[model samples]
Target: MEHRELGNSGVEVSEIGFGAWVVGTDWWGDRSDEQAVGMVEEALDAGVTYVDTGDVYGHGDSEEIIGKAIDGRRDEVTLSTKIGYDFYDNPQAGHGELPKELNREYLTEAFEASLDRLDTDYVDVLQLHNANVDEVTPEVRDLLREWKESGRVRALGWALGPSIGWLAEGDAAVEYEEFDAVQTVFNLFEQEPGRHFVETIRDSGPDTSVIARVPHSSGLLNEQVTPDTVLEDGDHRSHRPKEWYETGWEKVDAIRFLEDPDHADGTRTMAQAAIRWLLAHDEVASVTPTFRDGDDIAEWSAAADVPPISEAEYDRLEGLYARNFDIDRDDGMDVLRTSVDGEDIEAAGLDKRAASY
Candidate 1:
């Protein structure tokens, strides 16, 4: 399961993908569209060829249970979804926040209704769901470059959030160098706006690539929410604020030194060292991680053949996330959500408290 290429969009994907938003959502708990098509056929028998998903998640019923779990293997999967959520005239009040509609005739009738609920004929990454830097206009960037020059999307992204900091809609979709990817909420304890959209796409250039969603910071880098975990009722991490899981379980024990077990390539599971600390970011091509079943999709789709977090454990996780993880306190995400009025979260230095969107 090592794939890769979303940036130079020759379109690969599976370096541990499959976040079907916990398929047809109980917001990540219940499961039973035959256990969500047997947890996406046990993440396609563990090779996990990328799944994603979000046409307002359960509203389109998680792309119709990932089109019945990739019926007849659909060329062994690499799907991906997402379309700005109007939820077709909004009614979903429970998990709230709908109403988005990124123009171009409601994103071409919501990408042909997400290709008729992912029965598919296109879609290997489409994205734009949580869109908001003035809703990516210019006719939604020429209708996403005419659906990737007419193949109907082999790549194109932007899924920033319904929660974490938008960081000016991921720095205006990587400064509009026509994104090849962007999805956010990166892990090893929520690094700001996915390390400020991978350093604003490597100090300003394109080849976007960075699809890491909540790589387990919700479950605290994969200890599955400990400190006597009890987040039950409607658990979208129970709307996060028990001091953000007690300051994320003490920043997951100060990065448990990225868990090892005599690793020349064998034992590594703090959920595969929190997905090898976001694939130690060479622009993080993929790392979806929310697979809540089939033994969490056979231990994180074998975390793409583990053993990667090295460079001296990613420089001791960038000095334990520049010392915040050593546990001082307030990781209750200091009020985020900003847009141009906050001047792109104060030109991305991000001291927080903007909250406008």
Candidate 2:
């Protein structure tokens, strides 16, 4: 697997990282502990050296599963996890609308709990889960700095929440310089915020890395969902409007050129093509593709070996994004209202600036 340094932190992570959100909960489906651990082991065997999980994921069950999976091979991977949610008090905060708590006492206690759950002394990368731009206050920055100085976390980042492309937060993260990376939802379909985030980091100083989550456009790029497909009740995608699948498939078909072997210069699956499209950018440090089982783990982990999409193909995608191509361009702010129950965008202090397209 090809590894890249996470910003200037000197922490090398595999091009394809393991996303542990699905395994920890039935949000995707009911996965047994053995099934979850087996998948992580399979990912490790396939050369995935970075694992991204959150404390709120299955209410810390995800971290415990990871702790067990990497029991004897902790050194083989760089563990990255998120905090800043009060999941400890209210485990069922509903999807994407977890209450934020960034005070020092809350943060310190949260870090300790995460370490205990992961069976590790220090997390390689610690992130503020789903924080808004204004939420990343001076107090939060100082606490993260203290954590780094005290060796609780090697590097720090902001994992944009309620969906990707929080332009204000992404810009502030890069300018802050304390952040080593920023995680966003960047895939073949949802490309704006991730693209803008990468450009801003490159143009600015501090060498912040970009971690692309939802690299498959929530399974559209993964080819696991079709227009006819119906998601299960517990599945996270089930919450999205039916229009999301109908419109998403249209957008997916528009980018079918990415899957052409000739354009890719070699044989590549649609999913790998999607991931390589993101990896083509020099600023993307890692792309975490969600996996369901050992087989899924192997398939995505090998995506890193596929030849990159040519610059011409990359430009084609850029042009498609510019045209919008019948895709909804709400800047992903609708995610806050639709994905979670009772989420108030205005109450969250998110307005036009936060959802700038």
Q: How much lDDT does each candidate structure score?
A: 0.80, 0.80
Please provide, for model 1 over 264-324, each residue's C-alpha lDDT reduced to its tens digit, 9 standing for 90 to 100: 7577778888887788788888888888877778888877777777777787778887877
lDDT of 2 by residue, 78-163 (tens): 99999988977764745656677888899889888999999999899999987876667899898899888988788888888655
Candidate 2 ranges with C-alpha deviation above 4 Å? 91-96, 263-265, 326-357
Top-TM-score candidate index: 2
The residue pairs in collision within model 1 are none
lDDT of 1 at 45: 86
List the candidate 1 regions with Cα displacement exceeding 4 Å.
1-51, 54-69, 72-80, 84-101, 120-127, 136-158, 161-165, 168-183, 194-256, 260-267, 275-297, 301-319, 324-344, 347-357
Q: What is the lDDT of candidate 2?
A: 0.80
Candidate 1, residue 254: CA error in Å?
9.5
Clashing pairs in 2: none
